[model samples]
Target: MSPRKILGWLRAYAAHDDPLVATANLVALVVASNVPFYPVYHLLLIGRDAWPALLEAPVALIFFAIPWVSRRSGLVGRTLPPLVGVANTLFCMKILGEASGNALFLVPCVVAAAFSFRAKERWVMLPLVWLPVAVFLLSIDRMGAPLAPFTDAQFAAMLRLNAVSTGIFVGFLGMLYGRAGIESARASR
Candidate 1:
């Protein structure tokens, strides 16, 4: 498709009354946006492991393709982002370890789940919301130990990087969900 056509479709796809679908689409777009910067991040950060950091590019592509996938499967579209998010975070934690502060990303993953599901889906969303917490709690000791151990300087820098990045990601999610709330309120009128 032409660039204009693709953009139009993405905009239309993102417009949905279901909070899960809408939020997932936005999250996918935002996550996919980071694929291009993976190389830069690998060079400047993650000095030892170029491949693990770049592995995220494929995940980002998966997020980017979610809209297309969801067109055929609404359930998958609505649920895939958080499921994949938790899994991805876990993978990063295993490789990057607790020192990178990667676990902080789990907070937004749960928060988004809470907001994404409506009354009917609350039960279904509950397990997802806690999955990250459960896994992290069980593996807390391991997550803190860097796989290969970063130097003191690297540890401090990774912590700062993850902290700032998580903050920005959390804020992005808040804005998307917050906008949805406003729309919902206006619709009730």
Candidate 2:
């Protein structure tokens, strides 16, 4: 392509609505999804010796490639990273199945997507809010356990706490990253 065309493409890709905020939220999503899945898969799939080495490759591809690509071409690199990451997470969740840990990698997506909101984009968090609830309820039903057992209320409480705690964590993360996104947008202009 001509130099002018290349430059135009570069601007489009690296041009985030707010780079720092968007990038931070993206990084957080990458962490949230990869963190829980990594150990769970390691324990369930690769045993003690192999998963560590295998894990770094995709993680590197997702995060490192951002600045690397931006520095090199400045095109669609930043713009596309989040979608690529999400697609990869979905694949991982599917391949790992129950061993993926948590459900379907929904938590991280919800959290990251929340930070993407502008005033016009506020609707994004709605589906995100519902995902975990759906996952938890579905899990409970599929597991065929009572929501709370009277004699062993502690186990039920633990389950309830885990769900609530995770929800709160994701919400807090959404708020923090969302604020960062707003600041980044202001700074960009």
* Residue 189, model 1, lDDT: 84
- Scored against the true structure, residue 187 in model 2 reaches a CA lDDT of 82
lDDT of 1 at 16: 63
After superposing candidate 1 on the true structure, give the runs of residues whose Cα lies further than 4 Å from its correct spot: 1-6, 17-19, 35-39, 46-51, 143-149
Candidate 1 on 1-189: residue-level lDDT in tens?
899998888788665665557777878777777755743674487575534565556778777877777777656686777777888788777766776677777887887777766677778688878887897798787655544666667666767777888898888888888887777667768
Q: Local error of candidate 1 at 77, Å? A: 2.0
Q: Candidate 2: TM-score?
A: 0.44
Please list the C-alpha lDDT of all candidates, in the order they appear.
Answer: 0.73, 0.47
Q: What is the lDDT of residue 173 in candidate 1?
A: 83
What is the per-residue lDDT of model 2 for residues 59-174, given as tens digits with 9 covering 90 to 100?
A: 64465446445545333443334444455444433333333233434565555555544455445445554554565455542443222222333333333433564576566666
TM-score of 1: 0.83
Give the poorly placed runs of model 2, Cα more than 4 Å off: 1-22, 25-41, 44-56, 68-82, 102-104, 120-172, 175-178, 181-189
